[model samples]
Target: MRKVFLFIVLVAISMASYSQKRYENNYVSVVVPNGWVVQNKGDNGLGTELMSFYNDEYDANIYNFGMIIGFNQFQKPEFLLETQMNLKSSNPLFEKATFGKMYNSSFMGKSVKATDFKTQIFDETFKGTAYAFNEGGCTVLAVGSYKVGTKSDLPQIWRTVKWKNIRKDTHVYDSFREEIEAYCAATNKTLKQTPIVSNGERYVSVYLEPDANIITNTYKFVDMEKSSFDENKIEQIKQNLRPILLNILKATAKNAEIAAREMKEGYIFKYTYIDKNDEFLFSVKLTPDDYQ
Candidate 1:
């Protein structure tokens, strides 16, 4: 217990000093798992290694994901919480015994709150820790850990990491979002009002809400769906003035029949059926020339 507490305090106090990347001047800088993609970096120009981080196995059960001691192969890390706990329990030098825990929490000195997560895997268990320590300056360490089969895995894991220079984390570009936007633009889709999405909803979504003279390829994730539109109304609506939609369908669409439906409000064209296979929007097109 005392040794674990001492380690936590030591990490919290931070003997070594560092700052986040420049762009992260205000936002807290977080060290992410090595294989996770980092699209952008800080304010200063930094080497790709210093500027971004990514992980190969996003679903891999990674723990004790330490910067100063990260394993390269990622197949199996050397350090295991159980080994440390067992060591402390058996070692005569240590006075008290406690769970394998070394925790330090701070909010990049801004006084925000973020909790750590811990999970048990297979025969071994692990604890994930994330906290900012404001020692010389505020620094954040995000940890993920796993269990090792034997004591032999530890030394090699520690030695493989080039911990001599632990550089500040960075993100270089908005690759993911940028790609999404480009695809939507090419397809004439628009983004929804809010950037954040509901769980189970499209993590990233575009909309196809069309305007009077233009087809909106903007998308709304199904997670955000409400009772606004019914099958009756949907069946009644047709693909119209969004000029872009015509372009998109030009390649695959074999044929289309345009017609008009009389309503108390007004007359509208419906693209009723298309292609010999019955793949189309409405019964007619809303163009006046096609009404006759």
Candidate 2:
């Protein structure tokens, strides 16, 4: 009976030692498994804040068992996922990394888009999984990487996340996107009432399409045959209109708080002009250097 009681005590102690730790912020609450330590916690400077964890034993040399959680207020899940993937792919160390297809999956009680990836750095080959989902106004992304043959508890850790303050309302950025679309439509209607250019080119339409952090303003033009403008003439037109477009963009950015904030946060402004038949004329992309 004493031996049995001692065995029960030992089991209790072992369970206590291996218990998980919970971490929470305004965006999400998650569990970090035993043996893993927080490696880093800070904003990534590209509009998302990140927290990283790793197991000391498995990540002794290279990052064998590691996880990262990122939160963004306005970006969509797809945008956040693409941004994270691009950041990783751009790194010189991951040049040879291969990615698998992204598929729908459930993680942390939310439907998410998940992908698998593999990369080799030095003598270690690391396999990883990443997923992104939206919870309330926040877009959350989680990534886990482990050595090829190691037993990782990342899936268990992911299942422990609990989203706080759930809501079904549209995100702030989505509302802003609707406003911008309406504004563009109004501008297009006004432009239609007058000549868009002094050279008899009529305005076809003005539309906005956003991809990740880039906001594109596409201007459609017609009556190109009347102008008889070739490539050289189009180039000259673009050069002449560059400052005018820049001025308009600057004014809009100055007047709109979200536009200014987004610009400062490295959101790119792209202006594209095309013919009515959808033939590309030219495009000018403005980066932070040009805007700020």
Candidate 3:
């Protein structure tokens, strides 16, 4: 019996080590189990990132578990508490989630507030814990989902999220601004003169009508890449345009159906607006160059 117990303990330790994987950047480091894919770095937009680890092991169901980290010049002690209250009230999932009382906690020796929360989707209840901690002049968040009825090690994963002792180059925006001007001149579009500076990064807003047919809503993103000449950069612009597309679909065309297809370097967001009788009103191919 003593030998069997010792073997079981060794197996547990081995499995834990095998399941852990680490993701680190200049700002933060997090540990996630294998099978959690990291999103494209460019998709993070500026100093804030919403990275998720998605697992679709269950048929037709997906679980998103991850952290959001924001870098700022300075953060107050109340930052975490304010963020917790805001999330409890404003998060899109707040209405659907069943939350417990918020209580004080500490992570990596930094003061924090934590809450137990759960949400149901497709008849499966995803149990999770949310934490808000401010450390190293930044606001760090940890959110995770666990398989119900099991001993959860998610807090251990969160505890592994440590801040790095490095900072970003604040001049990236200035260099990107020059590129924006050049791209605008080449494409014959008016790039907004003023830029938004948040979290020590600059973002430029631009609007495109695509031949006087689509709506004139402006799209915005962090001015990271120098030019839209690259196919990959252009594709990233298309991803940024998705939210604008959905918001303007109704105003741009009646009963519109938006679809996207991948091209060599970029993508084509095809918008098909239909009439009351299901007849097509118009179709627009929203490409990356449109916003250049």
Candidate 4:
């Protein structure tokens, strides 16, 4: 009877020791098994390391997991994925690694792009997987690595991650884009690219440009195959499109007032016309004086 009681106590203690605990930062939260240490490394250019965990007992065995949340540049999953893959491939340690096919999978309630890799390092086989996803203008990446034939809790750990809604301000570029898109849709004009807001300046592009029939508002593309247009022709095209571009600026002024006010000073707007190949044909600039 005493042996049975002792066995029951031992089982309960083991289960308690393996239980998980929640860890979180400003951007994300995740559950990790007990005895694992979590570290947060704030803002490393590429992204913010929200949480990274490793068990001291398995540290020598190469067992670990990390999650990063990115907002400044490389916010797209495809771009992030490419950058990560390139970094790994360039590392001398993973020179002979075999990367697996990329696929879409659901993790932490979001669709993610993921891939697996295997490499041999100093007679020890290492296996790893990476995942990326974009949410609310931020990209999140989760990676896990372990030595082959070793036990790993990464899969169970990542499945319990939850993203926090922490972005309080919308990007000014998004506002400019929305207003420009609405104006383009109303005017039956097609935009060549999304509006870009950088360094207190906004740039927009359209598919058509003013030609010889500028008086009639008839737009066409220049023959780039022949040769690039001369300086005189380029200047003339810019002059012809000036009024039309100004009108677009005026039309979106009310909607973009909030973004402009945020800039406070030195706000410039540029509209460019591009060819089918996305080559720049001509462009016009509107200063605060022109838009106000």
Quick one: best TM-score, which candidate?
Answer: 2
Name the runs in model 2 displaced over 4 angstroms.
1-20, 44-47, 57-63, 89-96, 166-292
RMSD of each: 20.2, 17.3, 16.5, 17.2
Best by lDDT: 2
Please estimate how well model 1 matches the true structure, expressed as its whole-model Cα lDDT.
0.28
Candidate 3 on 35-64: residue-level lDDT in tens?
444431311223444444444322233445
Model 2: colliding residue pairs: none
For residues 1-292, what per-residue lDDT tens digits would candidate 1 score against the true structure? 3323323322222122132222112222344433332333222211111122223223343233232211111111112322223333221112132343443333223332233444443334444333322222223222333344322222333233221222333233365333323334522221222132222222133222243321122223343233444557555543333343344233112211110112211333232322223233233343333322
lDDT of each: 0.28, 0.58, 0.44, 0.52
Better of 2 and 4 by lDDT: 2
Candidate 4 lDDT over residue span 175-245, tens digit each: 54343333334223211212223222223333222221111111335334214677798888678778876
Over 4 Å off, model 3: 1-20, 38-45, 54-64, 71-95, 166-292
TM-score-better candidate, 1 vs 2: 2
Name model 4 segments beyond 4 Å from true.
1-20, 44-47, 57-60, 72-74, 89-97, 120-123, 166-292
Query: Model 3: what TM-score?
Result: 0.43
Model 4 C-alpha RMSD vs. true structure (Å) is 17.2
TM for every model, in the order presented, reads: 0.24, 0.49, 0.43, 0.46
